[model samples]
Target chain A: MAHRALRIIAAALVGGVLSACTTEPATTGTTGKGSSDGKLVLGFAQVGAESGWRTANTKSVREAAEKAGITLKFSDAQQKQENQIKAIRTFIQQKVDVIAFSPVVESGWDTVLKEAKNAGIPVILTDRAVDSQDTSLYRTFLGSDFVKEGQEAGKWLVKEYEGTSEPVNVVELQGTTGSAPANDRKAGFADVIKGDPKFKVVASQTGDFTRAKGKEVMQAFLKSHEDIDVLYAHNDDMALGAIQAIEEAGKKPGVDIKVISVDGIKDAFVAMQEKKINVVVECNPLLGGQLMELAKKVVAGESVPRRVEVKEGVFTQDEAAAALPGRQY
Target chain B: MTPPDDTGVGGRPARAPGARQLTEHRLFWPAAVLAALLLGNVALTHDFLAVRVQNGHLYGSLIDILQFGAPLILVSLGMTLVIATRGIDLSVGSTVAIAGALACEHIATAKDPGSLPTVMSAIALAVGVAAAIGLLNGFLVARLGVQPIVATLVLMVAGRGVAQLITDGQIISVSSSAYKMIGGGYWLTLPFAVLLAAALVAVTSLVTRRTALGMLIESVGGNPVASRLVGIRAAGLLVMVYVVSAVCAAVAGLMISSNVSSADGNNAGLWIELDAILAVVIGGTALTGGRFSLGGTVLGALIIQTLSTTIYTLGVPPETTLVFKALVVIVVCLVQSPAFRARLSRRRRATAPDRAPAAGDVGARQQEVHP
Candidate 1:
């Protein structure tokens, strides 16, 4: 057993050394040409598929990579910090030209990103940003303005419910606890909602951005509050879950309990069509095409914005009903 | 003389052929809890018994409960095996995401979904990938000597990242009719997911009971050094348990993606591991391991699903449901504790004979002998 253990250790050391020696060619001042042009090997470590928006975003990135003629080496961290670290190490071992990652959480990524930086493989933040104070760890961040998205939802809710009779006993369903989206959205919403004394957020809880959890939380909310007028869900799935809970309670959704949610997913539009949801703030997950383009530009030594914000907007029930057929989660 | 009360012997009789004894040995807790919940639901709701057929399938809130319980059941079955070895797999949720992505990505990437062979190959490949991840988890735990929880933790975090990498952080909407049927289609009068879980339970029971592998696992879990000394290849068994656990998670991922007709790796199996763990724990599997109860796990899964559904049906506030679920978990755990069991037994003796509390708690004597 001692001999076997020693052998395993030896093999791991050799493999590690070999990997360290043969790093993917560094992305110099120029991007690679075509597949025949020695395709730029790009390593992308993604956050797990957590929602409809995420799934679409991943597809977009893969398709964009194919279109751009980049060899995409992908890893799914299944929403864990450690899995992502292992993947990044493996990517460094494979020596990919460039690396990109949508961090699972906001923290615990500084060490890995610094390692990639040290290896001369430029890293880009996709969809989500890291929490490091060091800006030089990564090349640039390309994603939606999550805080702004929350602000938009809050702004719309303020205007929509301006002249209501009963104070809007708004219950906020937060995203995954400790996630960037959850924290940012909470900050943005509270920023606006705090100004209005009448607009009281009676309850707030993490639905973890899941339909089941959203439904569970909503059920509890209905039991506690008799006169909840509005539900500000962090995402659409949570809204959908809340809708189910409302229906089960024999209360008409849009009529009795108004819902304002982000993530203009197809299902949310369908809910809008059924008058279950009142409004949806759009977060364009089609950043993959833009991300791929930016990746190429970054590789080409072309100057890019430090933070590229994707063009997205808020949609009311009327807008949602109009775009129900075209809306993509 | 009288077989030395071999039931109390170490290492589960060390190769005994008493499958019936395993099943009949424990009772009450799970069954009684389930029975109590069912009676409460029936008595509380006006139309709890009402069932209807919609689109040629059963339609009711109860159906929803069963439907939601399906994935939990599948994951818990795998968990049962791992927990039986005094090990835990925290990565099943992530494995589900990876598997779901692989399944949907395969169908979406195909130029023609009509190619049955290609689809089959993709499915096979995805299952293979899931198995490989499982193998890695097993290797870490069994060979590298990492704690099972910590070994699987890496996958739990990185597995979803891998899935997202596959789908490129997108929701891969699959239009394949075959894929959709796995989650959306009905089997007989029940959801296909429920049917799949039921089939898995039966097959798992047969495999564990019929083969020496099952007994070997129990013995190893019960006493690792003794089993190793007896030439049971304990490391190999540990590895197998994790691998099987991952495969089960993959199956669940397929069902989920099909039901939604899309694979969103980020959202595919989020927090599902929590549900699976709860199910395994409630099903009467000790958190510290040794004995596994597939039947109990199923009942536990059903109870959890029903509790969630009931909260919705009964008009509980959405935000409080998490607290409620946490509370239910706490209550169940407390009830299972030895101290609670002893207290209840003492209280029972003071009450009337007919009204004595049901034997829902395992005796302290049994735990001491086993531990």
Candidate 2:
């Protein structure tokens, strides 16, 4: 009895070990809102509530739809591409005015976008872009420029140590290893800092964009290299975690080790206000207003840009303190 | 005193027919593998095994292994019992996420997040809710006669959503020093998490061994029908194990979220169930059920914890990290496995049967004693 159970458990463990069993952000259109006469009906598909950024993004979309007086047919694709595809099909069947979705991945959207295109329902991509050669499938893509955000962090680092000529040892707490943000941020940071001989990325490792891993890897980094001058995390949570690690190591975070992170989550602002995080590069999640505007434009048969980038900026301790009073996420 | 295993002397009496004594030395293989892995790390970092004190707290790779491995040790400790009952609770990871989420959300919304009372209530809420989940899982598996895996799988999938609901789909960050003490803060210059895990292990060992409960659980797992016929309440035992597993996972959840001072519903305790199961297996606990070892699970968890630290200390390239980790785990599994040991010894015995005559004699005596 035990052997069989062990085998099953072992098999289950092996087969599903790597899979985080993500809750695919798949939502079927319920059309819960009152579909008022003459109000533009917009179909929006969201990625799952995987993080604070995603939740804030979802809120921005929902709230913007309400404020814009547009009827939103919202569906959540819990991180599953197939769910997003299914949600898109439902939007097409419902014949909504405009269909908008954040592509869960970079591929497998050509067919669905084509379907929406054939139905004469204009599709707008938000937050994520699909790798479709046929650009006509979607009207516009609205998202943050991750590479630019990484460069902003690097630019801040260069300016912070502008007078210093000594070689600076830096460490990185990267997001998920193969994630778009992790790759782009690392590349952009490296691209900017590469020109300066004094700036050096001493060690870099993936923190999986999680707080626990962020702290764990930071601990390991501190033990391995005691002379780390700066920590460039791909996201705020990791930076916050590294701050705790730095404090535990008996060093002031902003003083001993300058911490730079991406994602302007509220927690990052709090950390900055506390003088833990040195700088935070904002990856704005409030794209709902722009998305609503683009949806209205596409529906009215007006020309829109092929790609739209959300405006974001770098924040330091002073800005973080000023912004913490009313920051949303 | 009643022994933990039902078998008087050896744990593998009926399971294996030959060389049972050598294979049943449960702690030897895992401990040896752990030592080897540490030594391998030493080749890279000279202070791999050195212990130092900084800020009145012990700072070393070994301490890191124990401190960081505390959660896994707790989860695997509970899993050891669950696996001992011929049942598995796959919902542990979800339970962990839910626990952290609930605690963090509570503290984040509390009137005073940093207050001791607030932290205590947050912990109570998480644990209380976990106990209820365990009751549900236990009810489904024991009372309703559902397969343990299937019973727990329902929650394993839905629990994340529940956690997200609690945190309103956000990573609830709290600044509670009292709460952080459970996971990140030290007590008496040692990680409180390590001390908590050690205390739990000691209590569990005393309760399960000093009494006949351990034998009862073994008997129930060994043969459910036979144990039931002997008037043992197998259903109750099943419920107890699942509850224990859930509670242990809840504590692990607290430690994790406290360590980071935040609870990320989607990522907290993600993929931990597999790690706990792997720890239980590596500790020489059979997933099939019966005799178990808590000490082995602790060593196994530490081994896993050390394996990850080893990867970073070696400065393994990011691209090859997963493959490198997999390779080391496979090596550990191979070394711990008795079949692999027997195969190696078989080749050795065949090559020099006459030269090492005493080895053959010992093997014969072992087989004679068992058979």
For the candidates in turn, chain A alone yields TM-scores of: 0.82, 0.90
- Interface RMSD per candidate: 7.2, 6.5
DockQ of each: 0.12, 0.37
Best by TM-score: 2
Q: Tell me the lDDT of candidate 1.
A: 0.76
TM-score of 1: 0.64
lDDT of 2 at B235: 86
lDDT of each: 0.76, 0.85
TM-score for the second chain in candidate 1?
A: 0.86
Which sections of candidate 1 miss by over 4 Å? A1-174, A177-207, A210-233, A237-261, A265-279, A283-312, A316-329, B1-25, B38-50, B114-119, B139-147, B228-236, B287-289, B311-322, B347-371
Residue B115's lDDT within candidate 2 is 94
Native-referenced Cα lDDT, model 2:
0.85
Question: In CAPRI terms, where does candidate 1 land?
Answer: incorrect
| Residue B2, candidate 2: alpha-carbon lDDT | 17
